[model samples]
Target: MATIDLTGTDFEQTVNDNEIVLVDFWAEWCGPCKQFAPTYSAVSEKHEDIVFAKVDTEDQQQLAAAASIRSIPTIMAFKDGHLVFNEAGALPPQALESLIEQLKELDVEKALRESGQSE
Candidate 1:
């Protein structure tokens, strides 16, 4: 799937509607953000089941601030309505792929139990 542009208006609903959402907070001027774009898009195409979304920090400053995005190219992954991964920086292709693989293998129920959160 192609990466969808997310704004403050649709961000919450989009994340809630999708089971697995990968949000990329980025700015066009950031070199690292540009570097990560292809890797992110490539991975998105490979993972049709996941919702790959991008927030242009320059345009969506409110959304980025709400998410506490202090750096460009911040990638956040959410699974089962919980934040599974959040990191700032451009991840290598292999690292991004590994992150997706790890997310796929996660046991949501067990994680909830471990966190002492009842479903």
Candidate 2:
């Protein structure tokens, strides 16, 4: 699937609707963010089941603040509407693929229980 541009308006709904969503919080002026765009898009094409969404922080300041984004090229992965992975930095294509593999093998409910997030 091609990456979708997300705004504050539809962000939450999109997450709720998708089983697995990868959100890339980025800005246009950031060199690393620009460099990461193609890599992100390329990976998105390989995963038709995943939602690859991008938020242009410059245009979505409130959303960025809500997500607590402190740096450009921050990537977040959500599974079953719960955040599973979050990190700041541009990942190489191989690393991103590896992360997807781990996420595929991950048990979200068990992870939440182990982390004491499940009540």
Candidate 3:
């Protein structure tokens, strides 16, 4: 599926509603963000079952803050309504693909416990 723009209004609901959601926090002026856009888009196209969403940091400062985005290109992955992976910086196409595989195989309950967010 094509990447969608995410806002604070829908962010929580979107994450909750999808089995797996990958959010890209970025700003338009960020060179690395620009460089990473195509890779993100291409990867999103390949993963039809995954929800690929982007939040423009400049325009969504509150949402960015909520996500604790300290970098321009922060990638956050959520599975089963829980955050499973997060990293700053751009990921190469292969790394992005590998991350998808890992997310698919990850045990969400175990990950949430490890992250100290188990409910």
Candidate 4:
């Protein structure tokens, strides 16, 4: 699947509607963001069940702010409506693939319980 462009208006709804969501917070000017875009899209195509969305930091400043994205290539992954992973920087293709596998194998209920977040 192609990466969807996310804005402040649709961000919450998209996250809530998908079982697994991977969001890339990026800007066109950033070298790392440019480098990571293809890897992100490639990973997205491999995982059709997951929603891969990108938010342009320059254009979607408000959405980036809401997500507290301080870096140009911040990657956020949500599983079962809970934020399971967030990191700043670009992940190589292999590492990104590993992350997707990890997210898919995660037991969301157990994770939420361990984090003290009730369902």
Estimated TM-score per prediction? 0.94, 0.96, 0.94, 0.96
* Best-fitting candidate, scored by lDDT: 3
Cα miss at 36, model 3 (Å)? 0.4
In model 1, the worst 10-residue window by lDDT is 110-119
Provide the global lDDT of candidate 4 against the true structure: 0.93
lDDT of 4 by residue, 8-116 (tens): 9999999888999999999999999999999999888988999999999999998888899888799999987789899999999999999999998999999778878
Residues 24-82 of candidate 2: C-alpha lDDT, one tens digit per residue: 99998999999999999999999999999999999999999999999989999998888
Off by over 4 Å in 4: none
Per-residue lDDT tens digits for candidate 1, residues 1-119, read 99999999999888888888999999989999998999999999999999999999999998999999999899999987788899999999999999999989998779889999857
Could you tally the backbone clashes for each prediction?
Answer: 0, 0, 0, 0
True-structure RMSD for candidate 2? 0.9
Candidate 1: C-alpha lDDT: 0.92
The pairs that clash in candidate 2 are none
Worst 10 residues of 2 by lDDT: 110-119
For candidate 3, lDDT tens digit of each residue in 30-85?
99999999999999999999999999999999999999999879999999888878
Assess each prediction's global lDDT (C-alpha) against the native: 0.92, 0.94, 0.95, 0.93
Q: How far is candidate 4 from the true structure (C-alpha RMSD, Å)?
A: 0.9
- Deviating ranges (above 4 Å) for candidate 3: 113-117
Model 1: runs farther than 4 Å from truth? none
